[model samples]
Target: MNTTTQPTHNTLFITCFAALVATSFCFVLRAFVVDDWGHEFNLSATQKGELLGVGLWPFSISIVLLSLLIDRVGFRAVLWVAVACHLIGTTTTLLATGYWSLYVGTFVLALGNGAVEAAVNPLIATAYRHDKTKWLNMLHAGWPGGLVLGGLLALAQGGGVDWRWKIGLVIVPVIVYSILLLRQRFPVSERVAAGVSYREMLAEAGYVSALIVAALIVIEVGRVFDWSLLLQGLLIVAATAFYAWYTRSPGRALFIIMLIIMMPLATTELGTDSWITSLLEPEVVSMGLQPGWVLVYTSALMLVLRLFAGPLVHRFSPLGLLALCSAIAAVGLYGLSQATGVAVLLAATIYGIGKSFFWPTSIGFVAEQFPKGGAVTMNVLAGVGMLGVGIVGSVLLGTIQDRAIGHSLAAHDAQHATQLHATYFTSEKTGVFGRYLALDEAKVNASDAQTRAVVDAVVAGSKKTALKSVAVLPLIMLAAYLLLLLYFRRQGGYRAVALTQSPPAA
Candidate 1:
C-alpha cells in the first residue's frame, strides 16, 4: 500500500464503478427473467420469491465474512476473488436445468455481488474521505446505470429471445471491470490510515449488532439445511456469547438504531424493485408497454438523481433527506397500489425519486457516522439490509400476494375457487414469515381460458393489494428517520465524525 504509486483517484473510481455495473447487470437481468423461470420451473409464487430471496440473502454471508478478512487480505486479492465468483456464478446460472440449479446459480451470484460491495464501498470512502457521501453516491450511480443498460438490452431483444442469452449479458461488464482493475495499486483503508486498531473497529459494531447478523445467518442456513431448531438456537447463542465476550459493549446506540431501520428501508427499496415488473405487469401490458420499461424508467430516474445527491445532502442533511424520502416513498407506494394504466408511470416517478437516494445515502451515513468501524460497519449495514429483504421482505410480499389472491377468488366465485384450489393451488408452503398456499403455474397454464381469465383478474388485484401492504414499510421508515433527525438536532446538528490518529476513549 504505497501512496505515491497507487492509481489516480479517477482511475480507481472508474474501476469501482465498472465493478458495480457488473453486479447490477446481474440483478436487473435476473429480475427481468424471473417470470420466465416461473414458467419453466412450474414454480409457485412463494417458490419464485424463494429464488429471488436466495439471490439476495447469500450476499450477507459473503459480505460479512469477507469484511472481517479484507483489511488483512488486501483489496486486490479480495476483488480477484469476486471476479472468480462472478464467472462461476454466471456459468452455473447459464447451465441451469431446474429450480435447484437456478437456486445454486443465484446463490453463487449473490456471493460475488457481496464481495464487490465489501471491497468497493470502503475503497471509495477512503479515496474521498473528506466528502464520502457525494463520492459514494457517484460511485453507486453505476448500479442504476447498469440497470438502465441491462434492462434496455433485455427489452431490446424482444420477448422472443432466449433467457440464457439475456443472462449472458452480465459477463460483458464483469470482463470490463476485471480489465480495468487489473494490476491497479490499492490503498490501505481509512481505519488503517488513521491508525485505528482492529479491536477498536470491532468495538464499533459491538455485540448486539453481531448477534442480529449472526441470528439471521443461523436461521437462514438452518432453513436451507433443515437443521433442528435446537441446533440453530445453540449456534446463535454461541456466536453471540463470543462476540459479547470479545467486544464487551452493546454497540453505539445510533448505529444499532440504524441497523434496525435498515430492515424496512431495504424492503421498501430493493424488495420492491425485485418485484416491480411482476407487480405492474398486467397494468403495463394493458397499455401495450413492456413491463420492464417501468423498471428501466425508474432506474433511469435514480441514475440522474443519485448523480446530483451532493446538493440534496448539503440542503437537507443526510438524516433529513432520508426522512423526506421515506415520506415520499410511502405516498408513492400507496399511489402505485391505486394507479392505473398511464397513471402508473406517474406513481412510479414519485417512487423512483423517493427510493433513489435510500441505498447510497444510507451507506454514506454509516460510513460518515462510524468511520472507526471502517469496512465492517458500512458493509455490515449493507449485508443486514440485503438479509432483511431477502429472507423477509421479498418472501413476505409474495406470500401476501398468494394469500390475497386465494381469498379474493374464493369470495368472488366459491365454486370456481374450490375447483381451482383442488386442481391448481399448491399445498401449504412454509417461509420465513409463515406457511401459505400459492398458485401452481404449471397447472394454471393447463386450465381452460375462462378459468385463466378469472384467475388472472384475481391475481392482478392481489398484486395491487400487496403493494398497498408494502406501503407500511416506508411509513415505518419515515418515523425512524424523523426520530433520527430530532436526535441529531438535539446534539447541536448532524455532522460527519472525523477519525484521529489516537483512538477515542471507549
Candidate 2:
C-alpha cells in the first residue's frame, strides 16, 4: 500500500496510516497488563514501574538518534525497520519471565515503539500539513483504539492469561503490516519537498537549531519524567513563592503541570486499576460475568471512543478537551470509589470516556505544535514526551501504592500478614496503577451489611489517609504545567506551531 514514486496522496499515506494503527495496537496494552505482569513474573511495584520506565528509556534515546537518522536515511526505511523491531519485540515479551528478561524485552519493545512513533508521526504531519492537528489526532486515536481492543482481551482473558499470548496479539498485525510495507514503496523525508536535497535540509542556523533542539529535548525529557506535572501543580497554590524564583517562564511550567494535574484526582476517582475486581465483584457476579469483564467493558468503551478520535479532535481543542475530560475523569474516579452496584457501571462508562482523550490528544498536540526539521527530530520529541509521562506516572503511582500497602499491612492484625502479603502481591501484579493493589478488594467478600460497615469504616479511615497523601502531588504539578504550556505558546507567538523552519524543509 505504501509507494515511493508518487506523492503520499495514495501509497505513502496509506502505509503511514496502517503503521499508526499497528504501532498503537502494539503499545496500548501496557497500562492494562502492567499489574498482571508483576503477578505473573513475581516483581514488585517499584520493579515493575522501573522496568516500565526502562522500556521507556529507548524512547528518550531514540529521539536524539532517530532525529539524526531521519535526516540521513529516509522515512520508509526507518518505518519498516521500526515495524520489524516491533514484531521482534512483540514476540520477545511472550518468552520473558525473569526481571532482566522482561526488561530487555521492554527495552527492545520501546525501541520499536519509538521507531514507529518517530517515523510515522512526522510523516502524518507532513502528509496532512494543512490540517496537521486534525490528522495527528486521528493518528493518535489509533493508539487508544488499540488499547480498547487489548482491554477487551484483558477482560475476556484477565491479566492471568499467559503474558506471551497477549503480546502475540500485536505480532499478527506486525507480520501483516510488514507484508504490506514490503509490497509498497514510499517517499523519504527528503522527497517530501520538491527539489530539496537531504544535506541542504539538515543545515540550519546554529543558534536556532540549538534552541529548537534544546526545546525538543526538554519537552521529550520532561514529558518522560513528568516532573513538572507535580512540581508545577504545587507551585500554583504555594504561598511561599518557590516557583516565582525557580524559572523565567512560569506559564510553560504550568502547562506541563496541567497535563498531569488530574492524575491524583483520577487515581482516587476511578479506583479501577488496583481495586477493579473489588469494585465490580458484586456487580460482576450479578451480571453473570467473570470478574475480568469489568476491565473488558471499560477497554471496549475506550476503543470505541478512540476509533472516532479524528472527529473528536476536530471539535474539541485537545488541551481544552482534556481539561474538561480530566475533570470528568476526576469525577469518574471519585464516583467509582463511592459507587455500589449499578452506580459503578455508569461511573466506569464515564471514566472510560474521560480517559479516552487525554493521551492521544496530547500526542497530537505536540506533533502539531513543534516541528524539528524532519520526521526524526519531531518524532523523537513526541516519543520522549510520552516516555516522560510513562516515567512520571510510574514513579508517582508506585510511591503511593507502596505507602498505601505498607499502611494497610501495618493496620491489619498479625494474622492478616499472610493476607497482607497476598494483597501486596496482587497489587504488585497490577504494576504502577497498582497503588491500592489488592487492598481495595479486602472487604468485598462480606455480607451486604458487613460489607457496608467495613467499606464505611475503611472509607472513613484509610481512604482519607490515602487521598490526603496523594493530593500533595497534583497541587504541585498544576503550577509547573501551566507555566510550561504558556511558555511554549509564547515561544510560538503568532506563527503556527507546526511550521518547521529549517533552511530547506525535509
Distance from true location, Cα of 476 in model 1, Å: 0.8
Query: Considering summed lDDT, which 10 consecutive residues are worst modelled in model 2?
Result: 201-210
Tell me the TM-score of each prediction against the true structure: 0.97, 0.66
Question: Each candidate: what lDDT?
Answer: 0.89, 0.52
lDDT (Cα) of model 2: 0.52
Runs of candidate 1 with Cα error greater than 4 angstroms are: 1-7, 415-418, 501-506
Top lDDT hit:
1
Q: Compared with the true structure, what per-residue lDDT tens digits does model 2 show for residues 1-506?
A: 12334353456556665665666555545544665676556555456556656555565456556766774676667776777678677767777767777777777777777777777666766666666666665566555555556556655665357656666777755766577677665443422353444333333211223233344345434443554755534433342233233322222322233323433333332223333443345555556665545655665676566656666665655555555565566556556556656776787787667666655555555444434334533443454444444444444444455555555555663544434344322532334343344433323333367444543353234332333444343334334445544665777632335443234433
- Mind sharing the TM-score for model 2? 0.66
Put down candidate 1 lDDT per residue, 1-506, tens digits, no spaces. Answer: 32733347788889899999998998999989998998887777777788888888898998999999999998887788889989999999999999889999999999999999999999999988889988898899999999999999999999889899999999999999999878576777889878888888888998999999999999998998889999999999999899889888888989999999998999998899999999999999999999999999999999999898999988998888898899988988999999998899999999999999998899999999999999999999999999999998998888888888788866766754366655666656777766777787877888899889988998999999989999999899888888888888899999999986443345
